[model samples]
Target chain A: MNKVITINLGGNAYQLEEGGYDALRSYLDAAGRRLEGNPDRDEIIADIERAIADKVRGVLGANKTVVLAREVAAIIAEMGPVEDTADADTAAGTPESTPAAAPGTAGAKIPPRRLYKIREGAMVSGVCNGLAAYFRVDVTLVRLVFAFVTFFYGTGLLVYIILAIVIPSAETTEEKAAAQGTPAATAQEFIRRARAGYYEGMRTFGDRKAHREWRRRFKDEMRDWSRDFRQEMHQHANRWWQQGGPTWTPRSGAWFALPFLSLFLGLIAILGLWVGYTLITSGTVIGLPLPASMPVWVAILFLIVVIQAIRWPFKAMRRSYYCGGYGPPCCGPLGFLWHLCVWAAVIWFIYWLTQGGHSATLHDLAQHLPGKLHHALSSLKQWWEQL
Target chain B: MSVNEKFSSLRKGLLEFLVLKVIAGDKVYAADILQELSGTEFATQEGTLYPLLSKLRREELVDYEWKESEAGPPRKYYRLTAKGREQLQETLDYWQKINATLKNLGLKSRP
Candidate 1:
């Protein structure tokens, strides 16, 4: 007997059997997720609910009976498979316009079962174990069948060899899950459970004296294997070095220009500082006039440029401070500070330019133009007047 | 792409316009509209139709009011708004333009 559940869809109550209710709820949930980012998501869902309610009515007709699971499934099928709906939207060439509401629907469909060798249970070959697993039979029974076949004819050996060669081993967690018809959750969980079961089976001989024994044995096995691996790696490394293997080293001779570059950068930094000092003192830096006199913002801007110029060489020097295999030198904090100075200088410079600095600077620049250019400008002006 | 898939996609695009045209002709419930569209190429699943109606209503191209039914639960009767009429006219003009262009090119309008 199936339990009945009451559901509210589109402001109307529906009487649905438990299976139908679950299917409808999941379908609707999947649809909701598919249309999550849509602006009219709520309206669309509401409309879907109304359509479902109408479907329920059509199925029930005058009987007013509880809806069945098959009825719900039929309705969902008519609505079309969730994945198909998403695919159609994509195939329609309007993915940007249509949001994928059913992200989980992609994985909901189970892949087909495949045959895999079960290494967990095998005496001669994993063929019997794999066949048993595929058919959900006892491994002993499969072995008995092979034994009987061997007595009748020598084809059993050849058959077992062929099966073993063809079938894939259930080595990974996902492969094991596929072999056993179970969904793969995590490799760690699968490995832990497999180890615990294997050890438990082994400990059955001693009447299960200690539960912690299995864990200790597993850890010791892992440790021994790692130790042997490390020793082998050490031996290989020594052999490689003896055979004249190349080692990573910085090209010290290639960086011979560092000193000269540092000197040139230092000179530029000093010039910037001198220009900033002149601007502070006489409202002009390197013959470029400031806005009227030295405003606080302009002075601050000039100081920032001078400081950045001084820090630039230092930053570049740090970039190659520790080369070779040590990775790139970190200038995170210094870079952040330099960027802050640059932004402050830019903002202040823009403020100064907007506050009557444009005309004053242009006047100074225009007065410094060459005689030939000034004469060409006058001739062009006279020709334009005549035209 | 196969011919069937192309036709399917072409039909899917026109569904919304065809539905709006149906509602513009008369104020009708979902079942009635479905009945009218039955045996026609414009026929679509209820799941596909309802959401479209709701979207059109949201866009202010259509409006609906619930009325109690004799057979079962209340039904939402849908009618085209003034904006919907204007949209329908524009859609018709666009369709006519395309049809005329296709005719001038000596190609069949429907495939």
Candidate 2:
């Protein structure tokens, strides 16, 4: 007794023998490949399927509900090989033939190449094997290159992991054929690839099961750890609040802002010292378009004031946070009025520096500064020569 | 190429023109068109016919309407458009001209 498989074709259900199903599936796959790049590929395939359904229905009886392999083979033969239909399409001067048949029939034995990760004969995630296939190189050579690069900071391993995630594995026979640059356009090639896939699946079955079990265990451990950590944090926060540890008071808000203000001032002082050193060494400022008349300390002070103006709202936000996160109303209108005045002053200063008569003075400094530096360097060279 | 290959290619080229002629006759289902060509040298399978019909439709030379069928689901009944008739007339005229030229050449070469 042969095993039967049920399939839906053209919205009708039919039972097919296992062998018959395989043959039909491969035949349809070949047809689909043959019609690749055609605009109406799906519609034509649907029509072909409906025709196959009609033919199969004609052969079925009340008692003989299951389609046998020989009947399927006969039907495929009547429908003709996909190659013949492609030939007819090309001969008929259909525009689609240029793209679909160009690689297959234009004296090129290879199909259009696409990069796909191969699962068969893969050592680790199949990335190297896929790369070797794509570039038509030996797998050992590709692996050796990856190994050599991995010694330099392990970037090669990182790249391999990324590629494993990015490139799709060739799971189906058709995809495998496409990956190898030889699309299976005949039943023999399809069956060969399908058998190879079956063997690969069998070989990897045990490893796959172990990997799945390990992943499940890891996920369970992670979930339990996170739950415990969250509970501990919750209990600690509750105890601290219950002890009345300075919650949501103006004094506490001042205490929080003090540290940030000191840190900001320290950072600005370090930056100012660095800019002063660069200016002395280079005899000119690097990025800043400051006029030579303007003092470095004046520029630094202006920067500090501008940054403080921007940080005003953030300071208010910290105060609100100490007030139990109730937002701006907790701080009241005085803080908002102070922020508006600071922002208006900062904007007017920036506009004066960029657009007011100061810009022309800055431009004159930019043009003359380079020439002045050149003259000084020449005079220093003359003095060294005399010595 | 071999003689058989050349002849088959020529027949394939003419297949589309013949399909246009068939659709011009009446609004017909795909199976009906297949049946009409079954006995002729241009006989083709549904696998070949469907794509060809689709191309013809895409070119705006033919169109189809869904019609209910008794045996199964609704079928697409195909008919030629106005442009298809104009194209068919030009093709026919070109064919006659070629035929006349071939006949004249044949009579002169016989001497």
Candidate 3:
């Protein structure tokens, strides 16, 4: 005695076996997801449901009351996969649209590829496997490339973390199909691929063994190349020394440092001007008689400049890395200027501390406090009398 | 490419044209249309036909009327609109032109 459930489809109640009902529900849900953006989605779905109901009635033939799972499967197959219906709609819209064909078949068009991290057979996060699948390259090659890049300032580690966050995982059958560039047009296709473990594209045992062998060979080749490179470097150094110790041109050496020197000098000049203005106005640079509110504003300005100075280099580095180049030369020169300003600010702050700026400001405040306090008390008394 | 895949893709491109032609013949029920094409290469499932018909209706190339059915609820009987007939005629003309071009090319290459 199988469990039976009554479902309302196309305004008619039909008794379906539990398994059959689940299958039908999932199929309709998938179809609904596919037709999400269509204006006539409800009508189309209704039509499909009505057609299914009509077919179910024919299958029943006044004898069977409850639809069986086997019958439902057969009915679904005869009606064709949900993807075929969706694809037909899209194919009409785009004249040259390629219908997704089942993978591993001759003349099958590979589905448009998407990067999705695989969960199965993953070493760390399935980033490398995802990359390998997308490019149709060996997983070992991708892992090796990442391993090599990691040696350079841990760039690969940073990139991996970012990709892990940004690239979605292959959670759904459709997403898995997209990750592998395969077509899971039908439920049967998905089941077949799942049974074959096809979604575990590149991290199988055989591939792992091959990767180990490749890594060992790579290490051997690297050792040989380094030894040869060191020998060549030694020979060049000896030849250079024998020719003439080293012709160090003063102009050439100074040319590179000139920009740094000018920027430093400019920073010092700006600092000196600021100090002079404060000294001339306030007898003690920090004893400016301005309202107490001014200090907070100045501190906020200082903080803003400091944070911007610190953030510039990291932003530039990220941009250059993601943009796939050494980035603009302005990044280097501007970065130096920002650093110089930050250093200047630090030195000026230290100078102020050492020069008793804090004490002088305190002293100035103390002098003004009593008179201000007396004035405030009198104003309070007058306001109380008026009240 | 495999011949089967090529044929299917070709059929897919021509399926809409065939659907328009079928509707142009007479006002017909969806089941009747399916039956008419069952023996031909243009035969398709209800799942495929319903969506195609829905798209056609949305595009204003076809219109449907709800008519009482003998056995069940009111059924949608479809017929081509003026725009649909115009589109069908244009497609037929284009197909004929291509057909003639293919024949001419075949004749020129035969000897």
Candidate 4:
């Protein structure tokens, strides 16, 4: 007689005879632990079982009728560990936690469950907040615990790794509750292979009534997981507006900060230059050329000084304008292109209105740079491109 | 007996089979399971029993239905699945091989 193994897939039962119960259980346990914390944990676990099922029908090469432990172990070993962090981060950061609630019905709490706003900064449905509710602690405390662990003994890192393997990423509040269970200790290479989804996966296998409840909740959670990526972005953007910088540009938009600073300094410098140059050139009969008739290099230096004075404030406060992984200040190559188009349009509009054009002096700026300065500018441009 | 000796005598792999075997006949309750295992070589530990029983229930070898108890509010009654009965037969066959070897070595009697 051969003992058969049955695994739950989407509330459906799948049976395998060759590998038997132990083989199936071990595969589920190992694969489940590996996929602990990922957002799509359920899907990954389901896929792993599907993969196992696909390979489970055949007997060993010898006279064996049932699948052996070694074959099951080999299959799991071949699957490798489930990786939580993936290419999804570049586009979505993480899959959105469960489906959305009705617009007017936001912030309603689920019964027998704690709920709170998650880290709108980087999270799947304020994962931290929901966790805080379950732990009966402050959200900051939960975050701090994770942060401290991640920082010190890599406890947080291991937890994250296990979570990526075991804990499903929170999409809806219901799923977040599930991730809080199970204090993951080890990879337990053997036990996992012994117990599939039906055994150790449940909170307590004593009763089946709660499972029926979990199944119903799980359907809602799946709906939550299948939401639009753009809506998630909108939710994130909404989060920003609620607690972040105001959208309206201030009257003193630094719009005139640089221009004013430059004007003030430039006027002072011009006045000083006029008075000093006039004094030196007018009074002194000779002394290496007149002050007012200073060298072209001196004029070039003055222009450089004016540009720096104007640009300094903008450069200093540039960090304040960072738009969350947005490329760079509006002066990079792309920004330059955008500015060119906008400027051309504005110029054309002005040309249409006034029908006139004027030109400034040939700013032979780049030509006047010292060799070292030229190298610095080139490096800066390269750094901008890398960004 | 030392706790480990007591646990070993009761645990001995066959206990899982016995639990499944006993439950296979009827949808028995938790107290009923405790009473049945008591009559056999298997001695159930308080701390470990509930969790292990739960694990067994999850494996689908045992299925349970809730019945309101006269003494308490409600209690869960468990029974074996057809799959569980098949599993019990398989375990018994595996046990027979080991049990026969033990008896031949004069290290065991009828269990």
Top candidate on DockQ is: 3
| Residue lDDT tens for model 1, A263-352 | 776776677556654654455767777666557465656566666756665656534543433333234565546464444544443444
Better of 2 and 4 by TM-score: 2
Ranked by TM-score, the better of candidates 1 and 3 is 3
RMSD of 3: 19.5
Q: Model 4: runs farther than 4 Å from truth?
A: A1-387, B1-12, B35-41, B45-59, B69-74, B89-111
Clashing pairs in 3: none
lDDT of 4 at A34: 39
- Where is model 3 chain A poorest over a 10-residue stretch in terms of lDDT? A100-109
Q: Of the pair 1 and 2, which is ahead by TM-score?
A: 2
Q: Which candidate number maximizes TM-score?
A: 2
Give a tens-digit lDDT track for model 4, residues A7-104.
Answer: 55333355544334443453355344434554545645554454344444333334553555456555444333333322222111111111231111
For all predicted structures, in order, the TM-scores are 0.39, 0.49, 0.42, 0.23
lDDT by residue for model 3 (A307-334), tens: 4555555555444443344554545776
User: Model 1 off-target regions past 4 Å?
Assistant: A61-64, A81-88, A91-387, B106-111
- Give per-residue lDDT, candidate 3, residue A270: 70
Superior by lDDT: candidate 1 or candidate 4: 1
What local distance difference test score does each model get? 0.61, 0.67, 0.65, 0.46
DockQ computed for model 1 against the true two-chain complex using alpha carbons: 0.12
Model 1: residue A159 alpha-carbon error in angstroms: 46
What lDDT does candidate 3 reach at residue B59? 87
Which 10-residue window in model 4 chain A sums to the lowest lDDT?
A: A90-99
lDDT tens digits by residue: candidate 2, A46-161: 87887888888878988889997667766776665443343444553322332343311221234577799986667656888989999999998998887656544344545676
